[model samples]
Target: MVSLREREAELANETQTLQTAADLFDASVSEAANLGQSSASVLVALQGRVDAAPLATAEASRLNLLQVAAAAQPVSIPTYQRASIDEKDLVDVGKAIDGVRLARESLPPLVTDVRDARSTVTAALTSFRGELSNLGSAIESEAAKAVTINDSASQSFRAAVTDAAARVKAAQQAGGDGLAEMPVYAASLDALRTENARILALEQAERDAAPTTPRNPGSGSNTGGGTNSGGGSNTGGGNQGGSPDTGTNPDPAPSQPAPDPDPEPVPDPTESEEPPIIIDPEPAPSGTVPGATS
Candidate 1:
């Protein structure tokens, strides 16, 4: 039997041999970054060879480069079998030999795959660029259409406004009832006035809702100039300003209270059957006047 040290040595050699085979296989399968670049460069150079080459010729050149890349094969890497110095190391040697042989056999097909993949990537990139260019053109066309539509709409709005203004002017010059002269224009004017009133009310509401601080806290209360002036004139001159009751109710005739109704007439006592007789509680005292009471 082989010594343990010898067996270990054989194992180490076997491992190294296998690792070399794996490295070769990896290199064969993986294409370098520059593999397709060389072919693309050749195609680009050919474009400059002729002054403005035909489109067909340029496309053909590119296709030919791609085909050449697809057809190219990778060179096989040389591999070595681990030498078996004795029968004890034969198993490791056999395994190493098998691994190296497989790596060598797989290289050509792997290289072919790498070349085809590179060519496919290049073709895809070219097609993508073309599609992007078309998309850009379509976007520009749509943008121009939108601009045209906007201009047409603007012109139509301006024309409508001018026509309405002319009709309103003609109706005013007619000097009859505005509605009689132009019903449609009058209705539109009424609608506009109503809208303006609504907008005014909304604006007032918004102003009321907004928070405010007095600018001059020291100043006394100040009513709005127009509102106070108009209100004072309508309330029977400013002399009546002191009476809170009279200011709101300008009609004094209705403000006076109605008089009370007369009481019901007493019944006529003389008309009754009874005659009047003066009452005497007792006889007058001796030597007293007849009418005197004691």
Candidate 2:
């Protein structure tokens, strides 16, 4: 039979454990929800990319057409006079020359239209590139966030599992007739264990369900190597900002000059000098011959 004090202490410990487990579980749930939101955002961003793909293709076609037209050389004609015997012949010849002149005049507008189309396509291409870059960055950022959430959840779940296991072992050690004597304590412990198990399962599932890291489309490598002639170096550096070797001091910055050492303390000349002693003349007050040998 457990004493009241022992039972109370046990209940207190169990309650504390339950509280800890509840906190961990709540954190895990919050993290999971955040990850879900991030994933949804990524999906929406990707969908936008998909929708823009066709526009990019169409723009590319228009650009190519305009480029071909822009490269075309203009044709020139030499003026020629036709012999006319009557009014009918002159009118026919004039009509034919007018038709040729109209066609020649229309060519310039065609060229202008082609140039404008090319410019429009080029702008569209620039926009598409920006969209793709933004989408890629967003996806990578979301993936990193998801990874962080999962890692934190994993740690929390492991800690909860360890705590619950310890409590269950302590309970068994207390010898309480198979957990029936302390119903509330037993129930709390069981609840903690069950929650911990659920957390572990969720962690595993998340791990398994995680998407593979995306690679650059142009690069054949799975490690996201971009297509730069300067090897696999990231053109814009790492994710955060700055270069990859930001902290590494292989070469110190040239702007910062080396610090000078403290100057040696100069010995004070006055420290070595002796203090002058003042000779007080003997009090001539009472006296009469002050200039005497006193």
Candidate 3:
């Protein structure tokens, strides 16, 4: 009974920091969610612009507009890159949250130094805080690096879009039906935009599943990646996929975490003279994220 009380006492103390970390972690997750959306939006637009630039360039060349064709040169599309935030940290958080709960309810070994209870979590939290601080920079760096070809595809995308439009207008001004292919060009551009909307973002059904990691003797993992990119596979087809800290008598048993709401389309796409209609991608009708326990 004495040892049980002592173990509880230690966990109770760790609970305070857990609460604090969870709040910060959740906030970071929100910000990251927003950033991820923005990144996806930009990349999708860039891809459309890069792919569609050729139509404009071709029209310009056929119309004998050397400058317009030159300006509309295609910006190379890149293999999409994302900030590689470690998935382990997320899993650690989830496990720590779960393990602590289990420790309190189920008896861990009697002599277990509850101090070790928070070690994995403490380390993970420390690592995560450091990574979170650099998250924006990391994201920016990845975006910048991936788009470097052709002098930054976003800038290049915008210029291409603008020049492409210019060529179309120029054709109108010259009284020569430019390329006699306006319909085909417009149709193609529309198709590309539609495809971009369809292909880029996967349906996310993220759940904060019950902590799956068992509590071990000396260490614990606290994060289930907290709904980050690596939490689970957001399958192309559609569907996929919190805690508390308090010292003293422990808060009532924590309810298993709820599913994270699917991500919405985030903002700030590169606009063009005739920008593609970038719709806020609607949520996928239905799908599952792999790795969700329930």
The model with the greatest lDDT is: 1
What would the per-residue lDDT of candidate 1 be over residues 42-151, giving only the tens digit for each residue?
33432322223332344454454445445545434344434544535766655555555554555555455544555554554344334323322332333344334334
Q: What range of 10 consecutive residues in model 2 has the weakest lDDT sum? A: 176-185
Task: In angstroms, give how far residue 48 of model 3 lies from its true place.
Answer: 4.6
Residue 119 lDDT in candidate 1 = 55
**Residue 265 lDDT in model 1?**
91
lDDT of 1: 0.43
Candidate 2 lDDT tens digits, 1-294: 333334335444544444444444334334333433333333332332224453354334334433433443332222233334353565665665554444445445544444454444444434433443443333334333333443434454434434433443354456411112123322333444456567789889999998666443434322333333343545443222323423222333257788999999997976856778889987766757776784
Structural similarity to truth (TM-score) of each candidate: 0.22, 0.24, 0.18
Writing each residue's lDDT as its tens digit, candidate 3 over 1-294 gives 233335446666545444444454444444433433333332333333333344333322322322222222121211211233443576644544455456544333321323242333334333432332233233333333333433322344434334444454455456433323233333434443444444333222123443344344223233333342344644442123322223222223457999999999776566455757767855644565554555
- Clash count for candidate 2 is 0
Q: Which regions of candidate 3 fall more than 4 Å away from where they truly are?
A: 1-9, 48-294
For model 2, which pairs clash?
none
Candidates 2 and 3 compared by lDDT, better number: 2
